[model samples]
Target: MASETDLGHALPASLSRPVLLSAVGRVMKSARAAAFTAEEQNSPLALRAYDLRHAAVSTWLAAGTPPPLVAKWAGHSVQVLLTVYAHAVDGQEDAARMRIERALADDDEAA
Candidate 1:
């Protein structure tokens, strides 16, 4: 992620809160409509809404948010949340292992 300083350097001087807010509102409205349509159609035959919620919870968990906070955002009880999404949390372990292996690989010059 870019730091605040990086953002300050990248953005134009005339950038305004109202312009950003309007853009964000449009994007959010489009995203919500898309989600609702997908959910209504059950497009993937497995309920996109459920998948979307699972993804949100998984991302929050991977980002180190506490389980209680994830539960609150997901509107699930902590027990149910943990039980249902335990496998999703395992993905983070896999990702960490991959990152470690990549970091430990021999340098091209050394090899």
Candidate 2:
């Protein structure tokens, strides 16, 4: 992990504390107002930041990141990770079902 100092040089002299604070204040104000707006308030985006998180996790899972690592990154228990993301987990049972059925059909043909 890169420390703050390692990530980049120190802020220039022109980037003062008051300037940073003012910019942060404006962003917070805008975010607060957006949070309360009816469109944002009732929309799925506002209702479930978790869905976005889920999508990210699903992508990570599909990309072959190990379950334990993904769970740790997601701040979820392994059990909870499995329960919530079963559909996205690799080696799904439903995929096996079709293969099993085909094997049975092949056996019937042999019989």
Candidate 3:
């Protein structure tokens, strides 16, 4: 069951799946017509509403959100979330090195 906040009101599971999918298709078509560029309309951008969820999950992971917290939000186990989103969490080598350096510096200061 969807929460009230999910769609501004709870979407009863009793709603037909076909009806929901049809509605999403209609919305996608209209949004594409209004907002998409010529090339974007031809491409698979926002091809399905599920793509938005995928983007959100990827963005959260890349933004340094904790894997456990992101997994909870995405309704996946930590292991599954890491497996799926590991590719999206790239370009952090410099940040990782800085963190390691800081930890070592702190340790040396304490000694």
The model with the greatest TM-score is 3
Off by over 4 Å in 1: 1-47, 91-111
Residue 96 lDDT (model 1): 72
Worst 10 residues of 2 by lDDT: 1-10
**Model 3 misplaced stretches (Cα beyond 4 Å):** 1-19, 102-111
State how far residue 77 of model 2 sits from its true place (Å).
Answer: 1.3
Clash totals in order: 0, 0, 0
- Residue-by-residue lDDT tens digits, candidate 1, 42-69: 4453233456667778878877677888
Best by lDDT: 3
| Residue pairs with backbone atoms closer than 3 Å in model 2 (clashes) | none
TM-score of each: 0.39, 0.41, 0.71
Q: Give the candidate order by descending TM-score.
A: 3, 2, 1
- lDDT against the true structure, each candidate: 0.66, 0.69, 0.84
Q: List, residue by residue over 37-96, the lDDT tens digit for candidate 2.
A: 766645555234445678999888766667888888888888898888877866755756
Per-residue lDDT value at 52 in model 1: 60
Per-residue lDDT of model 3, residues 9-101, tens digit only: 665666623466888889988999899998999999888988889999999988788898888889899999989888877887887788889
- Who is ahead in lDDT, 1 or 3? 3
